[model samples]
Target: MSAALRADPLADDTIAAILAGYGGSQWEAIALVNRLLAQWQSNADVQGWQAPDGTPAPIAAALQAYLAAAATLPAWADAARIERAEELFFDMSMLSCSLLFCASLPECYVVPDLAGVLHVAGQLEAHCDYRVRSTAAMIFPVMMKGGLASPQGGGIAQILKVRLIHATIRHLIVRGNPAQAAGAAVPALDAPCRHLYDTLYNHGWDVPANGLPCNQEELAYTLLTFHYIFLRGLRRLGLGLAPQDEEAYLHAWNVVGHVLGIEDGLLTHDMAQAEASFAALQARGRQSPFLPDPRPALGAALMRAMQDQIPLRLLKPFPVLLTRYLCGDAARIDLALDQRVNLLSRALFGAGMGLARAIDSVVRLALPGFSICRMMTRIVGYQFTVKFLMNQTRPLKLPPALLNQVGHTVRAWGDDPKAPRWMNALEARLAGRKARRAAPGGQPC
Candidate 1:
């Protein structure tokens, strides 16, 4: 690695920004750390609770060791970097959820307040709109339908239409940015966004409904949209998963690829191949197998949640209440369901309630003294995988040198471009490229 690349990206300014994101959230961080540690303690408690008498002692020992490793890693070691990532990711999650929620509302025929909604667009100052638009698209469907309790507002079709509208506005906003450098301008967005607006305005809500008959195709297009978002997020932040965790990262990437119908030959580990590999491992008992069990239950649960027609059933009263309190709106109650059934049935929906119940079950199953850490890790990973897969991000191959430099700079500045180095090199290169084109005179190809 070049010297610049080898330097830690979490230099001074970056650390400051990172520290700021988590400053007031220390209690949460400490609780998380404690929870991770307690998960190990739960394991020891497990031997006494659930483990069979014949189960090997090594299982507990291995888990203990992993927890120890996690705990001993200094909280501040890469504190800023992690916090910055979490901050952006958490914000994006909330924003995307809010956008979908609003779009789901009966009154929001076409989502409005473009300037307010697109404020996060400023986060993409470093990347192009195509990249931004794509990411937004992929995430749109999932976020719209995700973790919801309602059926009518949460269907994939409604989600797609809302996403298309959001994408159209996002494109227009980019094209209309007066501050964008000439070299960085994305003129192509103007036509497409306008075309989509016209389509939606002229034809009403029937465009995507009539156009995309296949659910998988709709899923694929939406996935493509958010792929760009994830890419832009990663790019703008100058972040990459640690190389040591390549397998884990690739697994997450492949999950999204599967949903998108993109064949990358990475995630195609079929049943036969899986069985063959399992047979080759002459390891311990069946329950204690060496291979990590793949998570299919999550996909099933997510699909179920999307098809849920009511929100009150899916989310806890606290979240619903909090959402209303923050937004200054009255909590929406399902009077129709209540009158037919009872008051108790009004607050919860099938899928949201189902997911909450399942999550609780899994957590409890992992409790009584152990496996909570593993469960939490697994849950966090799946959430990330789902989010990542649903993202509109894509891969862009930069010159290795440039990648390293940007990565290093991000590490230092906490991935904020407001710091000095981000635009310095990019501006110089863009200027150089512009000069070369301009030297050839008018309309240089």
Candidate 2:
């Protein structure tokens, strides 16, 4: 883990070798960024440039080699396990979204230094689009049907693009200062906000102190947020997967970790290992807190953005409470979610979590898969789906066709195949929607 803090895959990457020759030219960087983003934000089947990296760059050969390799799936990726994981994802689709907003996202902020980077990058409180875009960019593409293994799938493409984005940010951070190129200690907090990368570069990273912008440890940790934390969140909600399913889910994300340039050692095989590694890494993050405490602002902003979108006056306060519940006391304090919510909300949440689990336990023996926990989460997920994901008004750079696809997919989440008709009806009533397709061309949540 300590070793990972100072490592970045780009240091050994062919792309970085070519980028090195560019001499930190912002024009060259932006041109490349624009070119790649056009492919990334395209509808689908665009993770790699099918053609050469031919935009007048002298290092086209290097770029071609890098893309060809970076975009391919690793040999160790188990197709059967990945397929099982995807099936599990489909079964828990809505709950997955709920975990994303309340669990995975909050956990992502617990690493204070990572939160600092995100705070500077997104300023998510002031601009909610970053939150939505970041979430949508990752979850949708990866979890979609055939997203990872298929060449035409968007998951691999999206993840590869994310890798490029990470590399680009690292480059832009040390753009002018060659001293930072070697991952030497330095800071830059005064760059203008003309571009996202420029702002991130200027946000003042002490490379040696805070590690590289998105070091291997941080990247590995972030990968766990999506898989380990999500799986843990499910267990907390009494929605834990079967032991085999859990392993398969972990395996799938491990494959993703491989593509994201994480070391094999950084990945985990079982829940115990995942828990220990995650805890140790997170403890290291806490021990080395970022100055100015980026966690609180980022946490507050995330909660605010979530609250603003929840139309129910009663449920407005739920985001804070939910984040606290999913993330636990230490993480709650880390994210500044320690403040008290209303007694009513507290009561409702307590009843929702405590009594629901108790009832589900007793009922599960009688009815094979009955779960009050599942029902309540489904209801909450539905609200989040409508408010954040399917809202057509939010500006997105994605194509209308893709937006429509996302909207259709979200609408399909309205149903719970395991739930009986009454449970489904109750969920619909609570979320203020009957099971039906949402209007097409909606924005990705």
Candidate 3:
């Protein structure tokens, strides 16, 4: 085994313990999640659910036990820090959403193995819109509830549900798509992918107990994407957060990572650890033989889906532009978005961001409570989108039937012929602006 593989033997053991103690099997985990959802629907307290014969339901009992242990505030957890992080996060809601969708999600696809798994699972290419919305919905509950410690916090509940989903994916991939799980025919974008393939195939195979689909390393990569990459995107946008706020923000996600089953060794405590881990991972990824493909289609589709949230024709190109700017040139090239940003789009994006920064600076100086205003704006916008635009009620449910309906609706909307005409016109307008800017006197008239 490579030194990297040998260095973290405990991560594998930790994952095994987590799975075994929680529900023993993926199906059992799913059952637990269903029961939890049912309790939610009926407005019954999850901790109070009872099985037939007057005994505690096995799944509920197991999950409640896990939550009781996992959801507690760590000895290092700080309430004041968490409060500061929440304020910082809420104040930058729009930027956060942009980073989550455009930067963080696309970055995940850079790993060819992860990309292949998500693609085969119908989560990435097949139902991209629903995937994005579902992800955002899951995140919303957590952020709004103020981290994962509160008994009233939806984050704990939501993370638990997602944990079950991950387990199910692990089971399906290992059993049904063994070739993919073994990394056959998939490009290796990094040393980690190659290592993962070797571990799955060459190193002995055990199903559901010692071996699973998504392991600790992959989970850690995802956690980094959410916490590290999101912060990087904010910095690119010139949103400077206080050092304390940054550390506190990572602290909140560290707790979230714990509940999500990431091993403590892989979970970062502060920015220094996060940066070191991220750099090490990046170095590993650079050693992969995989050439980037499939990412362009995936990235483009993700940006297109955001048109629903942002209606203006002029603002259409900004998502792609911001993605390129924040994610850097290498990612832009890898994701097939390199050619998408023209001179006009770049100029417009720069001007718009500059204006936004100036406004934010003014708000910070003149109106001390401007963060609250931004938070309220985000809340109102979110409520409108969920309730009116999507015609879905709040506190979103992800039952199978509802998910199917959402996928179908989103696909139908994407297929509509009218969708591209507006986008085409928007592009044309942008091109015209570029042409005018290049004309005599460099004027836009």
Best by TM-score: 2
Candidate 2 vs 3: which has more lDDT: 2
Per-prediction TM-score to the true structure, in the order listed: 0.20, 0.90, 0.66
141 Cα displacement, candidate 2 (Å): 1.2
For candidate 2, write residues 190-302 as lDDT tens digits.
54678665676676667667776677788888889889998999999888988899999999989888877788878998888999989988998887778888777777877
lDDT of 3: 0.53
RMSD of 2: 4.6
Q: What C-alpha lDDT, on a 0 to 100 scale, does residue 399 get in candidate 3?
A: 43
User: Clashes per prediction?
Assistant: 44, 2, 0
Residue 303, model 3: lDDT of 69
lDDT of each: 0.27, 0.72, 0.53
lDDT of 1 by residue, 116-190 (tens): 122222322222233333443333222222201122211122232232233233223333211121123232222
Residue lDDT tens for model 3, 1-445: 2212221222223223334456355445445455555443111233354433432355445555554554444676677776676666555544466577767888876655455445544536556766666676566555543535555445665676666556545534443332234332322222232322232322222332222345565577777888888887667655546677778888878877776767677888777789898777655654542323456677777766664455556666666776777778777877777664557757876876666566666865754433322332232233223432355444346544334433343322211121123332333253232111132432121
- Pairs of residues clashing in candidate 2: 188-204, 389-445
- In order, what is each prediction's RMSD in angstroms? 28.8, 4.6, 11.4
